[model samples]
Target: MSQDERPALEDLLGAKHRWYHVVDLAPGVTTPGWIDLRPHVGGPQLPASLQGQRALDVGTFDGFWAFELERRGAEVIGIDVDQIPPPDTPQSRWAEVQAELDGAVPGTGFELLRRWFGSSAERRSVNVYELTPEAVGGPVDLVFIGAMLLHLRDPVRALEQARAVLRPGGRLVLFEPIDRKLSKRSEPLARLMIGSTIWTWWYANRACLTDWVKAAGFTDVEDLGTRDVVDSTGNKQRHLTLHARA
Candidate 1:
């Protein structure tokens, strides 16, 4: 690689930002993210090939999954509410925490990495609730949300909006943290609210997630099972991946 890429890599390295996706931007360079999800994609959680398909990636922190989908021949668009200057809303506080950790504003990392990779995938500064077919320009073939739903105050509404943004028979692949207590008890549609202390709104059990997908007008819903991820603090969390059809 050229010396020019070194500056960009240095900026990423120098920053204190907390990363969720561990992305290999180049042969010898990878982002300093806590969660490395590259191995799990295209196995069961994601499609093996997204050729000729249009995809939307919700809550794309650093364009990891968005770029991955694009690499698979999909025209990809990534949407998130992490503004450059930051907002004053509740979500902005979360962004602030990330900024303090990153030593830069939230959402700025995505722009930097996109330019670094020379990727053609599109990105927008939009909220999850604002996602609709009209807002996204048109319906897409795939909608992906990785480890994002737990942060939303209205996950059901978010899922409904995601469903609206998909073409008929289009797929929605979601990976989210499940409520472990409810999962252990085997309750149907049980949800745990962890509150603002951890910046989490609700933790839906597997049954809760499946029922929400069905209620959102999805024709078929498949539980891809659980995935264990370690956060930046070395905390283990169980996440469930759900595949639903619109």
Candidate 2:
């Protein structure tokens, strides 16, 4: 691993795998991720340190949050499915979407970055709805889910599953897209956009998201506010981060 023998990031970028999170593998060798989350590593959304804790990262695409948890001294387990789940569209459209996603090789970027970082975090091929205490080897001290609810057909059930594997009094961190204008209202409201896309389902306000967390049995919920994150396509999105106790 000498300077002269180091792998070129350009050469690595030529692979077929797509990166979703910007990660620094080596000096000046960062992956060109769709979303750059490096700035939010130590932000209020995540703890500065997770020493002596066990953490679970749901929908850990590309292992960004999982590796970050490991970096903060937590034993992390990242879970994702081998294939992308179809959107809640019509049955006729399901086949089309499934056919397109069939060619997608999930966890490739995650494995690549894991090797680069020499990460001890484990990646499990498990769907979010299938999460349980036994599935993850007992309760974890922290659970982190980011930008995944909008894509799910049953977000509340997914949150309940996340709560199932979290230890009592453990921490739960949720970060997801929020409708800025809709979030201004006092009442919880979520806009349904079922047929708008093949993956996206809801455009919920912050209050609606909070209600979902509460319904999942989490307590002491705290709104850490919103942040604008830019994607690789240069599209900026507003995301709300919430912290709760399981």
Candidate 3:
């Protein structure tokens, strides 16, 4: 990119970025996102080659996973509530950088990168509760939900929507934070909701997570294992990834 493009690129990024993928937007120029999620992209869990497959990325912030799927030869669609404009109220949860930019859009970051990379992956403004086969137009071969469930008020409904959008025997890959202590039990599906100080809704234990997924119409569910992710503050959070078939 030339000198003229830098201002626009800088304007597009959120000041308080909670980046989960380290994306290199241009030569010698990478998005300042700290999390390197590429390691999990082509792993046994994610399946590197999505050639000729139709994939849906739930809650795809900044289009990282959507672009990743496209790079692996899949036709992808990314949906996120962030694609819509926030309210004008003082308590509206708009990003600081978004509030600062002139003519800023909710999905500007994703669009900038998409145009920069010349990708064909599509993105839409949609919430999880509103997801359905009819709303999405058709069922897809793969559905990927990464790190978004815990924030939802109704995860079961979201999972149901995910299931609704998958073709028979299609795959649903989920990566979420697990409350490890609750994994020891085999009874009730335990979920811990964070304090009102944050926007998080429920943090499900491994057992609970699996149970909910199964209840959502997934026939086969596998717990991939607990992986640790570090936050911007260097604190580690344990997350579990699951693979389920609808």
Model 2 lDDT tens row, 96-176: 677766767888788767666667888888788889988887899999998889878788999999999999999999888
Candidate 1 wrongly placed segments (more than 4 Å): 1-8, 15-17, 42-44, 83-103, 189-191, 194-198
Q: Tens digit of lDDT per residue, candidate 1, span 130-195?
A: 888877779999999877777776777888899889998999988787877787755565554544
Question: What TM-score does candidate 2 reach?
Answer: 0.90
- Model 3 misplaced regions, further than 4 Å: 1-20, 26-28, 39-44, 83-104, 184-191
- Give the alpha-carbon lDDT of every model: 0.76, 0.83, 0.74
| Backbone N/Cα/C clashes per model | 3, 0, 0
Model 2 clash number: 0
Best by lDDT: 2
> Which order, best to worst by TM-score?
2, 1, 3
Better of 1 and 3 by lDDT: 1
TM-score of each: 0.84, 0.90, 0.80
lDDT of 3 by residue, 77-164 (tens): 8988753222221234445425544364566556667776777778887787888876666789999998888777678888999998
Better of 2 and 3 by lDDT: 2
> By summed lDDT, which 10 consecutive residues of candidate 1 come out lowest?
83-92
